[model samples]
Target: MNPLFAFDDAQCRSLAEAHGTPCFAYSGAVAEAQFRALREVLPSRVRLAYAVKANPHPKLLAHFASLGASFDCASIGELERVETLGLPPGRTFFAGPGKREAELRKALALGVRVQAEGFEDLARLEALAAGALAVNLRVHPAFDIDEGNRIIGGSGPSAFGVDEEDVPELLRRAASLRHVRIRGLHVFAASNQRDASKLIAIHGAVLDLAKRLHEAHGLVFEQIDLGGGLGVPYAPEESPLDLAALGRGLSGLLARHAWFTGELILEPGRFLAGPCGVYLARVMRIKESRGTRFAILEGGINHLIRPLLTGEPFPVKAVGRGEGTIPYTLAGPLCTSLDRLGEVALPDLRVGDLLAFGTTGAYGLNEGMTHFLSHPVPPEAWVD
Candidate 1:
């Protein structure tokens, strides 16, 4: 559980030497293992759509596809990524707000399942298609969690789904549309939920809503895309995603809602890929100011951007097996003073030593930039 030294001892040396510092290292086997764990719990009726935004690298997506997993794309661009990989149309789902008209047209053309976020999107899709457009309803699940602590999707006044009270009317409206087809219901309120009961409650609520939608509209659902937010461990002692509990809960829910027959979809982003990768950086300098030790890394917000923008902390560990204890605040190479990674209690540090951060698989690479300092983009390696 020591994130600092969790990988195969020999493999760590191999990665450091070959990929160099400040690079992201991914494990293909780890990714597959995570997928397999979840797959083992659910029935064959369930289909996992690896949320591409988690790690959209071509190789990563290709690996998921090989594991017989589908994809959950938030935009046409993400959909196009899956399309290029030759995944089947029905296996891919397009879900998110601000789905433009052009994007809807493209999704329809490609036969990708659509989860309409708002009434405007539903109306637009209805107007464009000649036949019932394969659609999913995103319901705004009531969550008992804070917004700032949660990720984009769940709870906290999310603009992602229709209100529960309006769902029946929404389905009625969809039924009225000659070109709109409502096939599934989706709900995702938050990610990184350590509480298993919250997820279970969310899923149950979604199923309950699905039941009402079905009864009210006579719509037989073919899928229920429980938008994935399975959290990965960030702290060294933190447990990895509790797959056993999630699977059991989901299975129980399916049994409870036996009347619904269709694929059970999960769009997991962090759970699959977060622990499988590490962001490496070389210490450029060690300085002390105002009683604070600063370890300025070669890469900055430009290279791995989220922490700076959101003030959220990512798990970090120093490489090279240092044993001494010291406290230091890590900062990116960006000129802006705000580009901080996080403060960590570490031993004596030296320049050129490699530092790796854990649980950055979700947004570290895919969402970083080359702005400000514009240091050369770091390289990446995928391991089995």
Candidate 2:
């Protein structure tokens, strides 16, 4: 696994000093590079919509907007953020299983395309719309999904989209709606998947599902949304997603499914935002008990809870300490025992030692339980 840190040791050290400890610094250059790297490889028929749920920092949003990237927003606040970009209609999308009436109204007012979760969304949208409305139906496929992450619940049962088997009934009911029309198919069946072949397989399955809907119900889709599951490396031994393979696979998919001339949309939240961040904190203390070593830091789940939630730690490096083989269990200053980051090998540490966590630009401070112990919310510094 290549290091995902946006800055090197010297840069990390300088950022920590300048921003203070327990703060996050995001690299604007890295963010732009990531977007360009993914967007440039995609075919002209495919659209890249950055998932705002990943990291909603205004600077990040503005940067992506400047790069001609559309947005996939999930809530009223997110929609408000994208609204600030003043993007034209269709550049912003609203998708969530539990969208409030206010959010739907907001989306409608902003002229955003919505990925309706179920009949409720369709009915509500119809009730709210003044005229005709088009939406992409989010389907929860019955087929197995290979994802093993907590972010997307596995194939068993999900609260997302309508179930695949019920689509016929849904279409039947949707036919009666006066204003709402299902113009697209949205299937999100994978999570944090790195293998392009696997992602392609899942995407192929989604297209096949769309075909079934089209053939059976005469549904003509204007868009086929293969929801984002593009993975990024979290560990040194792990490999990043193969962009070339993914691009080629998608292009080939398009070629094979020539019956569908509609555009393809990918809502990538992490793949586009994960590598541009570094979370800086100082070692508050070191303790050894019961033969276990602990390097307790100034922050933990309070500011970065992914480790506790996913059991995978963001890559960390001790600033300016070079490298060492000593293993240390990282603990946060939280009062709960669940407030741990991860166990990793780093140089010998002491009080005031600075630690830098990489690949946290996606789910770092934003997803953290910031008010749990009342630690001041970490400042987010956008480094140009």
Model 2 lDDT per residue over 1-384, tens place: 235899898888888878888999999999999999998889999999999988999999999999999999999999999999999999999999999999999999999999999999999999999999999999999885668875888677889999988888988999999999999999888888999999999999999999988899998999999988899999878998999999999999999998999999999999888999999999999999899999999999999999988888999989888788999999999998898999999988989999999999998888999999898988889998
Query: Which residue runs does candidate 2 get wrong by more than 4 Å?
Result: none
Please list the residue runs of candidate 1 whose C-alpha ends up more than 4 Å from where it truly belongs after superposition.
1-10, 143-148, 153-156, 309-312
lDDT per residue (tens digit) for residues 98-180 in model 1: 88888888888888888888777789988888875778888886654443455664454567778766776776666567777
Q: What lDDT does model 2 reach?
A: 0.91
Could you tally the backbone clashes for each prediction?
A: 6, 1
What are the TM-scores, per candidate, against the unseen true structure? 0.92, 0.98
TM-score, candidate 2, is 0.98
Model 1 Cα shift for residue 47 (angstroms): 1.1
